[model samples]
Target chain A: MISVSKLLCGLAAAGDGLRYDDPSGPDQITEQRQRKPVVVWNTTKGCNLYCEHCYAGAETEPATGELSTAEGKRLINELAAFGVPVVLFSGGEPLVRDDVTELVGHAADRGIRPVLSTNGTLLTRERARDLRDAGLAYAGVSVDGLPETNDAFRGEEGAFDAAVDGIEACLDAGLKTGLRYTVTERTVDDMPGVIDLLHDVGVDRFCFYHLDYGGRGAAVQDADLTPAARRRVVRRLCDLTREYHADGAEIETLLVGNYADAAFLVEYAREELGATAARRVYEYLRRNGGDPAGERVADIDYRGDVHLTQFWQGYALSNVRDRPFGRIWTDTANPLLSRLRTREDHLSGKCADCCYRDVCRGGSPLRALAVHGDPFAPDPQCYLTDAERQRDVPPADGNGVSEPAD
Target chain B: MADMRERTRVERSSGDGREWETFVRQDPDSSLRHVGSVTAGSEGVAYEQAATLFGDAADIWLCPAEDMCRYAERPLCDRIEDAADA
Candidate 1:
């Protein structure tokens, strides 16, 4: 999660310790505290709508061999024991399962913050109320574009209306709601309108997810944003975020699925806000570690299989069914899982040589694997120029500040 | 308690200038409190605008600005004094 809001607004919400008054000075100041990664639990492999870019390849029917409600509750308990701070209930469509509220309630009871990620088709007013009553902290609803485009992408006729209604229902029910827009070349042009629509409808948070090549997404990998296009899009998003923020709007903007966003933001700040602000941005990026996939992020599908990320399928370090989730998560014995822990030593090619390797961390290893067939290869989505990559990154020399970007 | 902090809330005004009253709560069990208002063209749009305009509250409520009712023309404190005098 590249917090566009934090980077743009300089607000310290979570994980970031930088004070607004006295920002961290140049020498690489590392945040000493390490909290458990937010874990994603796919509550069910059942979905009502068949989205074109469904990462789970979800169909209209439920998948065979999902974890039972009892097993899910046990898994939640194990995750809480593992020190996971937040558990995000994801899909197929999390709302498809009848006992989702019960599962969320159980997780919350265990003191783990529970969040809901859904397609928004089934989130009725009553259901949203029940979820709030059950202790759901936040709910993210996915929307690709306006009614026609969104409905088309969802592969349903009434999906757009239902989802918009769902957003209203969640708000009416008092459920803190957000919008997730998966950015594709097709939908990129619609971003401006999407932003306006979200503001008009009163959705506070908007996440722009760069296309990750996985499952159905692989079919349209060629349609992914070009480096130049991505830069333009990022600039637009940054401008909009700043505009809204300056006006005192509570709306937050975030970019996901791309670590390059951090580097981009750093460059943007240096160009616009000057050296001191840029240095603060760098500190925040370094503290957060641009990409947290293998190190901090972990996901479990409905079938109990664990992967580095929700988009990463086919590779499973272990399953919760075979052993407890805590054990599986900490067990670095698996070759891939072990390699992911110390990726710096194993990052191949340009990624290893890049000066900003610490910030990019070879970009998304999953994207690298998807396009290059090697998990350690440089991320195909890396948008930095050769000049930018080759620039000597000055070490944090005490409280020293580096020269401003030319 | 009423928020007395010096803060500037960015309001999303629908071009039409009509607005809706908005309310929010910290959690399910908490009572709803009026956060602010959102300018929107219609009630549906008002709900959306209100939802986005409010800060990180757990729940939100929106109704047309015109629909709200009032008990008296003066302040509650002033009303209590008048009733005692009467």
Candidate 2:
């Protein structure tokens, strides 16, 4: 995830230190994050709504052999033991499970900060209060677009209203809540409306997710914005974020699922905001260590499979049911997992030669897999041009002038 | 709690008699639309029911009813039953 607010606007988002190793961020969180990754546990595969781009291909009933309450608690124990700093309780919809609060409390008790990712239609006032009381740190509610568009995308007529209700419930119950929007050709136009509507409703954070090709999402791969369109959307998001900050709105905006935003931000800064800003953005992206799939982020599916990422459920390192998650993650003996950890060494084609490879690590390997049938292939979604991907000669001094060759 | 490494495998049952909400696409060009739902013991049964019910459709999708939690005003099960009645 790229914090547009932090990079362009110089805002210190709550987890900036831990996420980007920003010196201005909290030292304690950064120290803990260095030791362990953030885990997204797909608590169940059951969901009320069938979103067009659902990565999990979520259904209404929990998948056969979903981790039981006891099993979930054990997983929490394993994560706590592994020193995982955060556990995002995600699912078809986490609220579907009766034991969600208990699980959250268990994670909190074990020193793991438990957060949530849900559709938000079910987050009633009582449910939000229960979750807060159980120690949920944050709740990210997915709201793809405006009522009509979001309803069309989510396969529910009143989903938008219900989700808004859910968000208000979370805010009323004193839980930190945010909006999660997946950018697609169909939904991109509704972004301004979503932001304005949710912002008016008191939501301070908005996470815009790039559509990744996985699960049902693969069916709509064509719906992903064109390269030029994507760049325009991102630039608009940056401008909107700046506007919010300028207005003292204190709104936090983040872009997720695409690390190209890292390099794009630097370039955007250089061309628009100037050299010093570009340098600062570059330094932060460097600290972030590029696409964090196999390193900073880990996914445990409903059943016990550990994926390099939530979107890359196509591959699994091992099952936590058979081995401890810590042991599985650290094994690295799995060739795919090993390669993903050091993708800089394995990246092929345009990605291998791209100047910003260090900052993007070839973008999302899952997208590459979807397009090229090879995880090491160049990310088809990398919108950077040939000139932009070239490494430039370093400037001799602090000024933007390049030094002559020796 | 048992140590992760030392824990014994527990017997688990398959999702049987579960309600699966069905979706259908009229043709290749159309998006999947929510149809009615069917009660089945497994994915195979669910698929069979969906294909039989929405036979003319080009594609079919099913999600479990238990997974969808919604507000009391419009429960997913209630909607499914209404669709079934329709």
Q: Evaluated with lDDT, which candidate comes out highest? A: 2
Off-target runs (Cα >4 Å) in candidate 1 are A11-34, A394-405, B1-86
C-alpha positional error of residue A97 in candidate 1 after TM-score superposition, expressed in Å: 0.6
Prediction RMSDs, each to the true structure: 21.3, 12.4
What is candidate 2's lDDT per residue for A1-406, written digit by digit as tens? 7778878776234444324543222111463475578898999999999998998879988887688777777778778878898888998898899999999998998888888999999999999999999988889999999999999999999999999999999999988899899999999999999999999999998999999987788899989999899999999998899898889987878889888888888777777666655666777777777777788888988876677788866445655665678988887644455677888988889888888887889998888877876677888888998887884622112444322222
TM-score of candidate 1 chain A against the true chain A: 0.92
Q: What is the TM-score of each candidate against the true structure?
A: 0.77, 0.79
Candidate 2: list runs displaced more than 4 Å.
A11-32, A393-406, B1-86
lDDT of 1 at B59: 81
TM-score of chain B of each: 0.56, 0.60
lDDT (tens digit, per residue) of candidate 1 on B7-45: 322222121235466667857787886543544567787
- Model 1 chain A poorest 10 in a row by lDDT: A21-30
